[model samples]
Target: MEFLGIWIAAFLTLCIYSFLYRDNPFYRFAEHLLVGMSVGYIIILTIYFGLIPYAWDPIQKAVTGEASRWGFLTLIPICIGLLFFTRLSTRHAWLIRYPIAILMGVTSGIMIPNALQTDIFAQVQGTLNPFSVIGTLSSFEIFGAILIVIGVICTLTYFFFSVEHRGPIAGISKVGITFLMIGFGSAFGNTVMGRVALLIQRVDFLINDWIGTIF
Candidate 1:
C-alpha cells in the first residue's frame, strides 16, 4: 500500500510539473485536484475542530445541564455566523454587514496591539540594543549587528518624505535604496531556492524511490 501511494504521488507530481512544458489537461486535473482536496480538508477541519468544539459542544452541555447557563451564550455567535449566509439573499444582504463589522472591529482590536508589538516596538527595541551584544558576541557578530542598525536607519530615512532629499539626505537615501534592493534580491533568491528544493525532492523520489520500486 505504501509503494502504491508512492507511485500515485509520483504521477501527481509529474502532472503538476507538466505545466512547465505547456498548459494541458494533466496540469489542470492536478491543479483542480489540489484545490478541491485543500477546500474539502479545510471544511472537515472547521466542522470538527471549530464548530463542534467551540459551538455545538457548548450548546449541548448547556441544554443537558452539564455546564452553567453561560454556555448557551455560544448561540449568539452562531447566529451571527449564520448571518454571513444572508449574502445570498438580495433583500436581506444588509444583515451580513453587522457580522462583517463586528468581525473587523474585533479583529482589529486584537491585531493592532500585536502588530505594534511585533513590527514597531520589537524592531525599535532590537535596533536600540545593538551594542548590548558587544560583551558576549565576537567582533564579526558585533559588526553585523551594527550593519543591521545602519541598514534599518537608512531604510526608514528613505521613506521619510517630510524631509527633502538634499545633499546628505540624498546620499543616505541612495544607500537606503541599495539596502532595499539587497533585501528584495535575498527574498527572491530564498523563494527560488525553496522551489528548487521541492523540485529536487520530487526528482529524487522519481529516481530513487519510484523507479527503484518498479525495477
Candidate 2:
C-alpha cells in the first residue's frame, strides 16, 4: 500500500509537471482531480472537526441541559450558517444576504482596528524615528533612514490629489514613481523566489522520499 501511494503521487507530480511542456489532458486531469479531492476533504473536515464539535455539540449540550445558558446562543450562528444554503435557490437567494452581511460586518469590525494599528500607525512610527536619524548612528544607516523618509513623503505627495502636480510637486511625484517601481520590482522578485523555493522542495521530496524508496 505504501509503495502504491508513492507511485500514485509520483505519477500525479509528473502529470502536473507536464504543463511545463504544454497544456494537455494529463495536466487537466491532475488539476481537476486535485481540486475535487481538496473540496471533498474540506467538506469532510468541516462536518467532523468544525461543525459537529463546535456547532452541533454545543447545541446538543444546551438542549440536554448539560451546557451553560449562554451555550444556547450557538443556535444563532447555526441558523445563520443554514441561511447560506438559500443561495442555491433562485427564489430564496435574498435570504443569503443575511449571512453574507453578518460575515462581512463581523470581519470588517474585527479587522479595521488591527489593520490601522499594524499597517498605518506602526508604519508611521517606524518611518519617523528622530533618535535613529539624529542621534549617534553610522553614516550609512542615517542615509538609509533619510532616504526612506524622503521616499515616503514623495509617495504620499504623489497620491495627494487636492494640490495640482506642478513645479516642485511634479519633481516629487516623479521621485515617488521611481520608488514605486523599485518596490514593485522587489515584490515581484520575492514572489518568484518563493515559487522557486517551493519547486525545489517538491523536487527534493520526489527524489529523496519517493524515488529513493525504490532504488
Candidate 3:
C-alpha cells in the first residue's frame, strides 16, 4: 500500500513535470484531477474532521447529560456550518445571512484589535527604540533608527484623510513614499533569490532521488 502511494505520487509528479514540455493531455488531466480531489478532500475534511469531532461529539455528550451547559454553545457553530448548506434551498436562503453576520461579527471583533496591536503598535515600537540614552552614546545607527521612525510616522500621516497635511508634512509624506519604495525593492530582490534557491533545490532533489535511483 505504501509503495502504491509512493508510485502514485511519483506518477503525478512526472505528469506535472510534463507541463515544462508543453500543455499535454497528461498535464490537463492532472490539473483537473487535482482540482476535483482538492474539493472532494475539503468536503471529506469538513464532514469527518470538522463537523463530527467538533459539532457532533460535544452535542452527543450534552444529550447524554455527561457535559455542562456550555456544551450547548457548540450547537451555535454547528448550526452556522449547517446554514452554509442552505444555499440549495430556494426560498429560505436568507437563513445563511444570520450565521454569516454572526461569524463576521465574531471574526472582526477578534481580528481588528489584534491587527492594530500587532501591525501598528509593534511597528511603531520597533522604529522608536533606535536611541536608548544611558551614558554618551550618539551613533549614526541612532540617526538611521530615528529616520526609520520618522518615515513610518510620515507615511502613515500621508494616508490620514481626516486632517489637513501641508508644508513639512507633504515633504515628510514624500520621504515616507521613498522609504516604502526602497523596502519594496529590497523585498522583491529577496523573493527573486528565494525562487532561484527553490529551483536549485528541486533540481538537486530530482537528480539525487529519481535520476540516481533510475540509473
Q: All models: lDDT? A: 0.93, 0.92, 0.80
Q: After superposition, how far is residue 159 of candidate 3 from its true place, in Å?
A: 3.7
lDDT by residue for model 2 (16-111), tens = 999999999999999999999999999999999999998989988988989886898988999999999999999999999999999999999999
lDDT score at residue 172, model 2, on the 0-100 scale: 99
Clashing pairs in 2: none
RMSD of each: 2.5, 2.2, 3.1
Query: Model 2, clash count?
Result: 0
Off by over 4 Å in 1: 132-145, 161-169
The C-alpha local distance difference test score for the whole of candidate 1 amounts to 0.93
Q: Which candidate is the best by TM-score?
A: 2
Window of ten residues with lowest summed lDDT in model 3: 128-137
Candidate 3 structure quality by residue, lDDT tens digits, 1-215: 75565457667778888999999999999999999999999999988998788988898888888887688899878778788877789888888897889989999999999999999888777776555551344677667777777777877876876757778777877787888888899999999999999778767756665565567
Ranking by TM-score: 2, 1, 3
The digit string of per-residue lDDT tens for model 1 on 41-113 reads 9999999999999999999999999999899999999999999999999999999999999999999999999
Point out the higher-scoring one by lDDT: 1 or 3.
1
Winning candidate number (lDDT): 1
